[model samples]
Target: MQRYFVQESHWQENKVTITEEDAHHIKKVMRMTEGDSLIAVHPEGKAYKVSIESVGESIICVVREEITDNKELPQQVTVVQAIGKADKVEWVIQKATELGVSRIIPFQATRSVAKWDHKKQDKKVARFEKIAKEAAEQSERVKVPHVHRVLSLQEVIEETKDYDFRVFAYENEVRNGANRKLSEHIKEMTPGTEVCVIIGPEGGFSPEEADELYQSGFTSVRLGKRILRMETAPLYFLSALSYEWEE
Candidate 1:
């Protein structure tokens, strides 16, 4: 069954009014009509089995049954990724959301080459947000992962001080044959603990940046023996986390 997310304002009594883009998707694209059943995710992440009550200019769905199931990681994992060139950031956001990350933070590392113009940051973030929402719905996630505003390395470090666990994927660590792995730290984490992992851009992080992160309680870890791209490393780490934590 298809799933659509609706705002709180759309809810009235037992029915939801779907308008704008979602209405177009149902009426024209999917061609779904009255009596069709679909899952509607509320703003608070509750899922309800809804039967299409009516469809025309808007989609009106009557709530049939409430779904108690939730597909999300027990731990809230935040991926702090350095802005990369091209559409790599979008690819990262889409794949990471599917892999069950709770939040994503784009960082401006010392060696990061792709710089977002201050004027267009909001627009770019909005695009990433849309990608995340669609990916979450397709992956059956209850809550959509949030795309945080881009921050400088110092700002990122300051913000992550409250996180329970932090690690940075440093290519140099793999080169040095560090035996420590992210799983080692993950295994020690309790449920509901927040984990943040940092990944560098195309040029990777500078030595000073790595040192600062390490000094601020981030474990310098390697994803694998082989080097992965800026976009691929975070996904790999998230997959490893899922393999370890998910039942």
Candidate 2:
């Protein structure tokens, strides 16, 4: 069944009102009519089987049942990705959502190639969020992962204070033949732990930036012996996490 994330105000009792883009998708794209069934995810992450009661300017659905399956990762994982090329960031947002990331934070690293225009940051963040929503629905995620506005590396470090564990992918580790894999660090994580994983840009982080992050308590972990691209690093980390916790 198709899935749509419904806002809290749009829901009343067992009925849900889906409007705007999702309504268009149901009416034009899916051509769904009355009595057609789809899943409606609540803002708080609850999902329900909903049957279309009416389809017109808006889609009105009646709750059939609450879906109990949890598709989220055992622990919350936030990807702090340094802004890279536009396409690469979009790919990360899509794939990371499918991989069950809880949130994405794009930051401006010392070596970031793509710089965010402060005036247009909201538009860029909105676009990233749309990609996340589409990916979440396709992956059958109960909730869409949030995409934060671009932050400075220092701001990101301050934000990590709330996370239970924090790690950054460092290619230097691979160069130094650091044997500690991401798996080693993540083994210390338990269910519901909040984790933050940082990925550098294409040019990678400068030595000074790495030193600062290390001082701020972000453990440097090697993805493997090989160095992954900026966009690939987060996916690798998320996959390893899924293997350890889900599989």
lDDT winner = 2
Lowest summed lDDT window (length 10), candidate 1:
181-190
Say which candidate scores most in TM-score: 2
Residue 215 in candidate 1 has what lDDT? 86
| lDDT of prediction 1 | 0.90
* TM-score per candidate, chains pooled: 0.97, 0.99
On residues 136-157, what C-alpha lDDT tens digit does candidate 2 reach at each position?
Answer: 9999999899999999999999
lDDT (Cα atoms) of all candidates against the true structure = 0.90, 0.93
Ten contiguous residues minimizing lDDT sum, candidate 2: 179-188
